[model samples]
Target: MTAAIRLATARVGDLAAVMRVMDAAFEPAYGEAWSGAQLLTLFALPSARVCLAWDGEQVCGFSAARIAGPESELLLLAVDPRFRGRGIGALLMKDWQAWAAGEGADDYFLEMRADNDAVHLYEQSGFSECGRRPAYYRGNDGMVRDAITMRRSRDRDGED
Candidate 1:
């Protein structure tokens, strides 16, 4: 029988596999991929956590985030190209918010390039743009892209 796909909390031991997922998910021409060292350092931080969706030994997707005080920020979310449009990214987003909410986070935020196709997914997940950074991201082709900051409110009073 084949092992079923499942989501799990990522650990240091999973770094290599996680990086493979990241590399496969991102388009290298965009220069948005994070190196293994960067991911290792981020995961090693006290406030950061990663959630991985795995199919047996293969990493299908992952979401990394940081929680500080009453707020939490999604640092990165990626799913292998072969897994796109299969609801993997949405599951990761929901998991990130749910995990942070359980930890007393009242506001969840994420920053992404304005042209990202995932913006619709984020909006569908209850996020709204709260800020913007002009020309914040530069691609390998020398073009700059705007960055948008989105927030999801977990409190009834709309306060973070």
Candidate 2:
């Protein structure tokens, strides 16, 4: 039987696990994986938060985000390739949103390469395309990709 997955708030010590997941989930050609130092910087920020998903003692996924004033942006979200299709991404999305809400964020945003398959995942989580930046990312393969920005608002009652 496989181990049950669980989510937890990530601490500085979980950096290694986060890196492991990021390395396994992100393609090197995309050049999207962040370094341990970068993650540590985020961890130091009072406005940022990180959540990790664990399968037994192993970290299977992680989501990082930050809240600024009334806005929250998802900095990164990754699930180990071996653990995809098991709803880990969706779970992390939910945790990110919940953390943002608790932080009093009225809007949530995320940006990713235009061709990223996670677009569907964000859409299913209530995020919609809001903007785009042409040639925003130059991958390791020497190819440039557009960046797609997505947003989700907490004012769902039409009472803004």
Q: Rate the local accuracy (lDDT) of all candidates.
A: 0.87, 0.92
- The clash number for model 1 is 0
Q: What lDDT tens digits, residue by residue, belong to model 1 across residues 1-160?
A: 1136678899999998889898898887679888888889876788888999876767899999999999999999999997777788888888888888878899899999999998999999989999999999999978899999999889686432
Total clashing pairs for each candidate: 0, 0
Q: Give the 10-residue window scoring lowest on summed lDDT in candidate 1.
A: 1-10
Residue pairs clashing, model 1:
none
Assess every candidate by TM-score: 0.91, 0.94
Weakest ten-residue segment in model 2 by summed lDDT: 151-160
- Residues 1-160, candidate 2: write the lDDT tens digits: 2238889999999999899999999999999999999999998999999999998889999999999999999999999999998888989898898889888888999999999999999999999999999999999999999999999998765322
